[model samples]
Target: MWLPPSPGQIPFQQGIEAVSERFIGAPFIDNALGEGPGSHDPDPTFRLDAFDCTTFIETVWAMSLAPEPKEHWTDHLQKIRYLNGEIAFTQRLHFISLDWMPYHEKRGAIVDVTRDPGLPLAESLTTIDRKAWYSKMHPAKLREFESRFPADKPIPAFMHYLTFQELLDNPQGLNRLRQELQKGVLLANFIRPNWDTIKYIGTRIDVSHQGFLILKGDRIILRHASAVRGRVGDEDFVEYMKAYKEHATLKGIQLVRFKSL
Candidate 1:
């Protein structure tokens, strides 16, 4: 097995699996992280006791990437969770399609292989209007971001994607996507309609859920923290996709992998 340079601990993608596997039954808490020492956001800056989906992935990846013998995972988490490693609330990569993936892609940290997994690739266009979005947020959350919210102008981005129906029908695409999972690519199953006007958050997001896709022999597993499940858990990815077929806005899955972890 290829291991990252972290002494005895796994520190990359393989390390990611090793690290996350230990938290299979951990509790899931929404909006978990906060600026503990020198900023706003009351939640603890770091903790392994509980996690939301985003925090779970952030914590796992950070732990996998950090050098061992000194548990400095938070340092890695800062860079992964924020723009330019800023710990402030506003600078955090709140939107997955707009801020999170793109920022890491540019830094050579990750690569978006959403299209490489299939034929007949598609796109998800989302308009990000930070000012208008924050206007609808709760008073306290808005107060934390009011000073740094971006302009209200529509910044439309086309996120490369694979259509769920197409992948379901296209044996070729289905096979390829499975191949990617077998290769250890993380899968971000997107949910949210194009031109969606409903207020879900301050930033328009493409993916509503994300998880690591691990393949062992013929069995594929999805490891993630789910509030509905009330804990970090592993589920069959194919079954999960079948469930998403009944969802109103589940667009499809986006393929991503860490290149620098």
Candidate 2:
């Protein structure tokens, strides 16, 4: 069973809705921009090139639940779980969402897997033993590695940790992987992206009914007072999005507001 998020905790469920909206309106996906390295599975079945952070986390979650029995894992099943295949989490009941809201509660536990004292925070959350978990990169030392990437590099450098063979063969490996990702997200959010980042302060506007007002820094962005219901022209949606972007810039966050949720 799952527990509800406390009042002090950020509404990650709401945030997920907001993210979905942004995805619908975005000009281009992060994958198209070469956000991260493509998957390296030789099956010719697991080729995926897109947002590495989300993809990696999602895969870790899927692996945790094990969609099918180990002995029954066929080529078809592997393709379904692999990157090149349809990567929608909802399609598989095993898919897990590792956002802060679900795992940050008091009962939630995180297992830290790092040698350095500060890359990611997993040690303090869960009671699980650290030595039992397996990881190539320590959560505390990720910053040092990321620092090596220059500004000129369009693609972010991602450390290769797990291979298809290891993930499939090793028992209980996926759960460990999921915990590691949760730690990474916590550390990244804690140290780097605060509420100031435009991507974080998302907006939802209604076109047909009523919209909300969003304040980015000091600028006021108007969400369409009316919610968009049906048959709205794409051009009109584009215009509304433009207004939201303008408002975001005025507020001091250079963000592209596109989704409705």
TM-scores of the models, in the given order? 0.86, 0.20
lDDT of candidate 2 over 156-199, digit per residue (tens):
11111222223233564334433433322211111111113223
Q: lDDT of all predictions, in order shown?
A: 0.73, 0.25
lDDT of candidate model 2 versus the reference: 0.25
The prediction achieving the highest TM-score against the true structure is 1
- C-alpha displacement of 89 in model 2, angstroms? 13
Local accuracy of candidate 1 as per-residue lDDT tens digits, 1-80: 21223334334434778888867788888888887755557788887678899898888888776766366667888888
Best by lDDT: 1
- lDDT assessment of candidate 1: 0.73
Which pairs of residues collide in candidate 1? none
